[model samples]
Target chain A: MALPLNYSFRNALVRWRSTIATVLGIALVVFVFVLLQSLAAGIEKSSSNTGDPRNIMVVRKGSTAESASLISRQTLTEIRYFEEIARNENGEPIISADVLVLASLPRRDNSGEANVLLRGVTARGMELRPQVKLAAGRWFEAGKREIVVSAKLAKRFANFGIGQSFKTGSATFTVVGWLDGGGSAFDSECWLDADECRSTFERDMYSSFLIRPTDEAAGEKLITRIEADRRFKLKAEKEVEYYRKQTMTAAPIKWLGGFLAVMMSVGAVFAAMNTMYAAVGARTREIGTLRVLGFRRRAVVAALLLEGGLLALVGGVLGCAIAFYWNGYTTATMGMETFSEIVFEFRVTPKLVLEGLAFAVIVGLIGTLFPAIRAARLPVISALKSI
Target chain B: MSANIVTIRNLSKIYQQGDINVTALDNISLDIASGEFLALMGPSGSGKSTLLHIIAGIDRPTNGECRVQDIDVAKLNESQLADWRNQNVGFVFQTFNLIPVLTAYENVELPLLLTRMNRAERRKQVEIALEIVGLADRAKHLPKQLSGGQEQRVAIARALVTDPALVVADEPTGNLDSHSAQEVLGVLRTLSRDAGKTVIMVTHDPKAAAFGSRQIHLEKGELSK
Candidate 1:
């Protein structure tokens, strides 16, 4: 018969000092593991939350991101009037050819400088993204050299307040408003008039086209038509799909999180193993007594494993709780696709918490395996003789 | 006379102490009757404890047969031996090896936990066992909170809780003072006399041996003439 759970639990309490040490060791490892993973999760969430399913994005065929793609005005004109494209109440086709540029700006905290994305779009482009809403002041007027900064970006970058000016490529532009991107990729960029941006940067081509289709079937048809046309040399996909592909930026962070967790868990395993070994050594006589009382070798092993698992579970919970404090906390990292700072909130999701707990339990079980077997294998006669 | 509860024939246990074959028990033959308080007295390394462990199925003999309650313990595999011991044997130790974290009540309740009895039945048996040792009031006290004598009595209660046919105690009074030793010895005597338990105890103390109904001595791994 198996020993009662209370036996393992009380033994842990009786050896509180070592129990706490092992628990904290595992806790610190799980904390680092969860925190690092949450960073990757946050970046993935930021990208995947962007774009609407009904809208389509057109970029140069070989380019991986809008910032790297170039489509000329002629190509935009050739595709803008397709019957599949949706039109506004005023009977104008809801399509926008946009330009993307990068400018290095100083941080409000004076923490060196980071690359910020500048997205120049027309009034039609603003209508295509209903998720981005003006949070303060008025939208920029056409050809005024005025810009609307993302509410999130305004909090981080210098000279982003209303009426404040920042210099980029010998041209000074004033911030006219703050727009909230609803935690989407657009939160990482500043917006101005597309024509003004092309003239100011001396660019002859638009970076990408954002188009809204009349319906899902029409969007699919438009995507298929653009991909099949050999003349334009352009790729078209649902806007949501395009943003989802940008999650590749989180791959390196995911790898780093996994690597750090694996490394720290090795140390945690040894620490737990040491604690269990010491417990077995200290309770040699007790083990023998239980054997003589007719507890089998398996029972002893199971009891010890239960104790180890419980100990690690507590550590897991503590670690998850500690990491939860970072949830919704805003942070910035360089976006691999745009080569600019992408601000996102740390997200400690429920699934991540479960994974952390499972990791801790596995570590506990592995650490206790050999020590528990050793305890069980001890000769009852000799164990009773131990002082 | 009551039926024999434990039978040993030509039992020998040899240890390989790094190539030296040291004999712990050598061709010993003995029979212990039910309800008998039998004490095996010897000095250190005299093999009295080894014999007790063999009879209790905690250790297997190198040769020959040890049958307790008609089951040949030495012939049984490890798992069967454990089940046999759980069903038919209880044990006591000189150190009063009550789990320190558990209270006296929980300590006594341990052996019963192996049985199929429900909580109420187990509680009833545990209470009776503690009452037999006159420590029912001290049932809630932890081992560290009890006197050495009280702890040994609690161990005795634990031994009797499962109502096993045989109870083997190895140096049950080795760590107790004279007064506490008497109290523990008294409890064992009561178990044999009133409860009809077959108790096999190993001790070097003449006074402790005197408390048993019968006594045997061993020397150099052999029974003394």
Candidate 2:
């Protein structure tokens, strides 16, 4: 017969002092696990959630990221005339030949200088990326020394907020507006006029092209056509797919999260084991009483396991609360793809919280296994003899 | 007056303490009839507890037969012995081994958990058991909240809740005062005389033994009747 569950819970409350240390130890581990995983998830979500599937991106054939991609003006002019390219109401091809540059800037938090990505795009660029929206002020005017900074980026870098001017080399650019990228990678960039950026940076080529396709099949056709023409030395991919690839940039953070969780879990396991061992030692007579009352070894083992699992579950919940509190909390890290600060918020997703809880259960199971066995295998006569 | 509920023959229990072979029970042969209250009296280290444990199926006999309800307990494996004990035997401890965290009602409800009865049925049985022990009003109190005599009563209620044929108690009143010990002994007397339950208790007090239907003394692992 299954033992009453409240029996285990009451025992936990009776020995709460020792239970708390084990619970808190597991809690600290879970807290670090969930938070670090949230950080990684936030970074990955920002990258993968970017761009539309109907749009196509054209970049240098061998380049892994847009920062390293360079397509000359002639190549863009040729690609825009393709029948698969979608046109706006004004009979203009819906295309953005964008430029990307890196600028070192001082952080507002005085945490020293960091590299920031400066993106140059035309009016068509805003049309292609519907995820970006102007949060304050107005979009930057074409051919002027005006730029729109992402709200997240504006908070980090000095002089990047609306109405402020920042210098990149000899040129001065004013932040005319703040753009919200809706948790997309665009939140890490500063946007200005494409032609003006090329002139200021003295670049003769564009970094990439963002194009809207007529349809889904048109996107594939465009890619095939671009790849067939080796002279252009460029490749075309669905914008959504291209952006999803950028999630690889968050790999290190994901690894670090797993590594730290595993490391801390070792300590958590030992703490739980110690608590359970003490519980067994303290309840020697009780064990004998249970056995004498005809409870099988398996039932005794299950009761102790249930107690340990319940304790770790409490820790898991506390850790989840700690992580949940940081939801939407903004931060920045250097992107492996762009080599610049990528602004993002911690996303304490439901799936991640569940993962954290599952991790705690595993630690609890390992911690309780031997101790539960010890309690169950205790000699009934000897145990009853214990005072 | 009744058939044998328990039968033992040539039962022996040996313990290897380091280099010495210590005999806890030696060639013991006995029979306990249904509804008999048998008190086993012995000095310290006389193996009274060990023999009680063996009969209760909490410990194994080193050799020979221990039959309860025609099933040889000595032949039972650990799991089967546990099942046998659960189905046929109840136990009361001297320390009143009531779980300190549980209320009196919950403690009484423990052995009933091994039965297939539902919650409502278990509740009814536990209530009746508490009433029999005259602790029905103290059901909600924790073991620590109750006095030593009250705790022993709760333990008795727990033993009876399972409705077992045999109740094995080791020093059931050893920790209580004279008045409380008499109260506990009175409860055991009712179980054997009125309820027809077989009870085997190990104790040192002759006054406690006087309550039993019959008494047997043990000295150095051999029965001296």
Which candidate ranks first by TM-score, i.e. highest? 1
Which lDDT value does model 2 have at B95? 89
Per-residue lDDT of A192-276 in model 1, one digit per residue for the tens? 9999888888889999999999998999899999999999999999899999999877899889989999999999999999999
Per-residue lDDT tens digits for candidate 2, residues B51-107, read: 998888878888989898998887888788877787788888888999988899999
RMSD of 1: 1.2
Candidate 1's DockQ is 0.78
| Candidate 1 clash pair list | none
Using lDDT as the measure, which candidate wins? 1
* Clash statistics: count for each candidate: 0, 0
- How many residue pairs clash in model 1? 0
- Chain A TM-scores of all predicted models: 0.98, 0.98
Models 1 onward score TM values of 0.98, 0.97
Q: What share of the true interface contacts does candidate 1 keep?
A: 0.76
- Proportion of true inter-chain contacts also present in candidate 2: 0.80
Kindly report which residue stretches of model 1 are placed more than 4 angstroms away from their true locations once superposed.
Answer: none
For model 2, state the Cα shift of residue B206 in Å.
2.0
For candidate 2 chain B, the 10 contiguous residues with the lowest summed lDDT are B78-87
